[model samples]
Target: MTQQELQARYEAVMMNAFGAPKRVFERGEGIHLWDADGRRYLDLLSGLAVTGLGHAHPGVTAAITAQLGSLGHVSNFFASQPQVRLAERLAALTGHPDARVFFTNSGTEANEAAFKLTRLTGRTKVIAMEGAFHGRTMGALALTANPKYREPFEPLPGEVVFVPFGDEAALRAAADERTAAILIETVQGENGVVPVPDGFLAASRRIADEVGALLWIDEVQTGLGRCGEYLAHQADGVSADLITLAKGLGNGFPVGACIATGRAASLLQPGQHGTTFGGNPVAAAAGNAVLDALEGGVLENARATGAWLAWAIEALGHPRIEGVRGRGMLLGVVLTRDVAAQVADAALKAGYVINAPRPGVLRLAPPLIATPEDLAGFVEALPGLLDAHG
Candidate 1:
């Protein structure tokens, strides 16, 4: 079917939550996608930073198929090998082998679980960063600071506070003995790939400790090697009581995990929280496959290629280009003018996929497996593309 036909069908049936469809992509491989019209485009957004292993990776496909053929899902009542193994893998990766895992189906659910876990600390107050995007759910939505996203859904959960991102003094002023948890994104992905100011995370840790609150790090977009590290907060040499993950964990598979470490692991007792399909074998197998791919040099490739891309984009010194923000593959191309949406649309016409998360910020989260050559092509084309659209 044609892209227009598919779009018309989608608009007629699906909710208009995401506005009109951009294009009907039929298939993808590596860092490339083919629309219904058979035109190819390099995908730099990685399905909003979920497809870390790229599209249709052989190992992930094989793992999911094998698991489905054997034992797809057994619910949370029964123990599944893949589920247990993936939990162990995540525990180890978090630098806390004893950390407990609560698997969910999406990043929003993971954050929800963490939100509940924080309540178990005998405190109702939670402090989140400004410009944060936790999720659309009621509990997560309360922590999200965007007025547009929160205003429509009033009467959200109460006692949630928002402070300036990376402002140690603001955080300190907002946090107190009543604060149950201090939630933060190591790198504010939804806020234009903005990394926390250096030493800010460590300070938050100290503040959380002082107030007897849990330090929750939301790594939904920056974890699982997306930022050239297993967890972005690792660079700060501080560990969080709760770490929420999704996005790249399952390499496009619908899976998320809320990991609780130290004393926070035991907060949610039996029957307090659960999911029927959270740790099903299929998703767990896919998660394992992603971990395997990352261990097999994908992480190193991200570091190398990401640095190259950042340097190349900055080296261009294009008149419209302001600078680059973010670490590793999670980058935001800041523009001098508020034409990010125009640039993104022009990029689509030029056979590329990117996103304008903010008015003047173009977010790029190419697959971790993307090569320097692939990025170089985007770099070479971006200057001219910006000139045409900027």
Candidate 2:
């Protein structure tokens, strides 16, 4: 069917919460995507950083195909080899060998699982950072501080205190014995790619320890080599009691996990939390393939490309650019003016794709496998795109 016809059908059939579709994508290969009209654009955002291995990655496809041919899913009642292997790999990569994982199908579900884990600690208050975006689920929403998103759903799970994103003092002052957990995003993706200040996460660990609260870092957007590391928190040199991951875990195959470490791992017993589609064989195989490819040159490529992008952005010499923030492949271009949305739209018109999380912030999280040449091409086009906004 035509793009317009499909869009109409979507509006009729699907819920309106997400608004209209951006463009009807017919196909994708590597970093390029084609709309139904055959217009192609570079996928810089990588489907909001979920497609870490890029579109149609051979390894991911092969793993899914092989797993589906054998045993696709048996629900959480029956355990599968791929599921167990993926959990083991995640626990190892998380740097806590004793960590246990609870799988879900999306990042929100992972956060929900972790949310419940906090409850098992016999505390209810959670300290969340301002400008945080955990997810839209009720439990995740409680931890999310934005009023525009949370105000609509009032009387939510209460006792969530919001502190400034990078202020260690405010966070410290807000914490006490009543706090169950302190949740943070290593790099705030939806808040326009804001990274926690240096020493901020470590201080959080100290505070959590002092107050007897669990430190929970949400790596749903920055994990799985998205920021040139297995988990972004690893770069901070701080171990979190609970870590939630999803976006890049399965290379867009739809999987999430809540890994709990130390005493936190013992919080959730069997039947306390479960997901029907979590840890399915097909999703686990896809996750394993992503982990396999994350090794070797793929991770190095992400680091190099990310570094190159940051340097190029800084070198753009555009008077309108306030600064560049974030680490590795996850970056936010802070415009001096509130022109991020216009700049992103201009980029799409120029055969590139990017996302504007806020009016002044343009976020870019290209595939980890993006080539240096592709990086250069985007860099070369960026100045022109920003100028077009002028």
Candidate 3:
């Protein structure tokens, strides 16, 4: 069907929450997507950083096909080989061999499991960072600090406090013995790829330790090589008691996990938490494939290409670009003005895709496997896109 016809049908049948559709994509390859009219566009956002291995990866496709044919999902009643292996692999990737994992279907669900684990500490007070974007679920939403998203959903789960992000003093003042957990994103994804200040996370760890609060880092958007590391938190060398992941864990397949280390891992026993389709065999297999790609130099591509993109964008000398912030592939080009949304729309028309998490910041987290040519093309097109927007 044409894009307009499909959009019309979607609006009539689908919920109005997401508002109008932007474009209808039919197929995708590495770093590129084709719309209903077959017009191609370079994918710089990577489906909000979930397509780390890019679209239609051969290894991932093969793994999914083989696993689906053998055994897809057996529910939580029984165990699966892929599930066990994936869990162990995930824990090992975190650099904590003894870390235990609880799988879920999305990032928010993984966080929800972590939230319940926090409650097992006998405290409901959570100290989260301002400008944080946890998830949309009631529990996750409660932890999210954006007033715009939370104002409409008032009376959410309570005892959640928001402190200025990356401010050690604020965090130290807010976290006390009563705080159950201090959740943060090493790099705030939805807040325009802003990396936490140096020594900020280390201070968080120290504070959480002193106050008996769990240090939970939300790696949902920055894990699994999205930032050229197994997880963005790895760069800090500070370990979290609970680490949540999802976006890139299963590549394109839906999967989420809450990994807890040390005593935190023992908090939620069988009956305490459960998910019907969390560790389904298919999702496990997909997770394994994603890890394989990460271990097989897809991560290196993300680093190299991301660095190249950063340098190229900087060299553009565009008047609108104020600065660039972030690490590896997760980057935010901060505009001098609040025209990010318009620039994003212009980017789409110019055969590229990007997002605006903040009004003045254009965020880009392209596929980890994006070729240098694709990266260069986006860089080359960016100046024109910004010019048009201006």
C-alpha lDDT values of all predictions: 0.93, 0.91, 0.90
TM-score of 1: 0.99
By TM-score, highest first, what's the ranking?
1, 3, 2
Model 3 lDDT per residue over 1-390, tens place: 899999999999998989998999999987789999889999989899899888998888999999999999899999999999999998987777679999999999999999999999999899999899999999999999889889899999869999999889999999888999999998998988899999999999999999999999999998888888987887888999999999998878999999999889889877988999999999999999888878788778888888888888888888999888888899999999899999999888888899999999999999888777867877877888888777
**Candidate 1 lDDT, tens digit per residue, 164-191?**
9989999999988999999999888888
Which has the better lDDT: candidate 1, or candidate 3? 1
Better of 2 and 3 by lDDT: 2
Clashes of 1: 0
> In model 2, which range of ten residues has the least summed lDDT?
381-390
Q: Candidate 2, residues 141-164: lDDT per residue as tens digits?
A: 989988999998888986899999
Report how far off residue 92 is in candidate 2 (Å): 0.7
Per-model root-mean-square deviation over C-alphas: 0.8, 1.1, 0.9
What is the RMSD of candidate 3? 0.9
